[model samples]
Target: MEVKVPKEIRDYQESIFFGLSTRQFICSLLAVGVAVGLYFGLRPLIGSEEVGWMCILGAAPFAACGFFKYHGMTAEQAAWAWFKSEFLYPKKLVFKSDSLYFDAMKDAIAEGEKPPRKRKNHKPQPPTGKER
Candidate 1:
């Protein structure tokens, strides 16, 4: 006779195997398959060393997706979001004018004068009754 006790529930999700969730497992498999396929397919045409590198390049993206996480999102999702934000709609398009301080510094340098240095804002306190 055998008895089984139910395990306690955790607040966070647990991995199905080796710290990899189902999606991660699938991603890892896909990455490995792609790498192996590429390596084998390219081996006859190119050197084995080159094929190995090609395998690495082909598998790196899915490996990243499988093995990495970002801000609670899967790596592939984060990567897509980043690609869209960076390439489709860049964040640097805002029309902000450059600061004239650097230009002034450059002009001063051209005129053979040293650039003005910024001073720290440390004001001396009036005589405190308590001594350090």
Candidate 2:
């Protein structure tokens, strides 16, 4: 089935620069900025090339984070969505012990109340004598 996505979502997914969307392009720029900043800041304490390389390596994952997608969502969007789902307004959850105990208690109560109900697919028993 073809799912109809909103125009806004489609627009957000469109590539504006090379293969990167505006958000992704901006994120890449920010990552480069952070790498440069780290290189410069740490050059005095460490060696220039070593620190620069380390900074680039470290910033690579953060930069690439915006380049992928999940469930038709951009990587950044997916990550943020996951964060929200995990921490903010989570769904109701039951503990294993509670669920097991509740299920057993429910079964006990149901057993005490009644026997099995006849199903629609149940066939009537055939008579052995006159009634067939």
Pick by TM-score: which candidate is best?
1
Per-candidate Cα RMSD to the true structure, in Å, reads 10.1, 8.1
Q: Give the TM-score of candidate 2.
A: 0.51
Score every model by TM-score.
0.52, 0.51
User: lDDT of each structure?
Assistant: 0.82, 0.79
Residue 101 lDDT in model 1?
80
Q: How far is 80's C-alpha from truth in model 2 (Å)?
A: 2.9
Q: Write the per-residue lDDT of candidate 1 for residues 1-132, one digit (tens) a residue.
A: 996444744325557988887877888999999998998889899998899899999998887777686777777788899999989988666776587887658778788988767999999989878887
The ten-residue window of minimal lDDT in model 2 covers 95-104
* lDDT for each residue of candidate 2 in 7-113, tens digit (9 for 90 to 100): 77655467788988787888898888889888888888998778978898878876887777678787768878999999996998876565765675787677786
For model 1, the superposed segments whose C-alpha errors exceed 4 Å read: 1-11, 87-132
User: Which stretches in model 2 have alpha-carbon errors above 4 Å?
Assistant: 1-16, 95-132
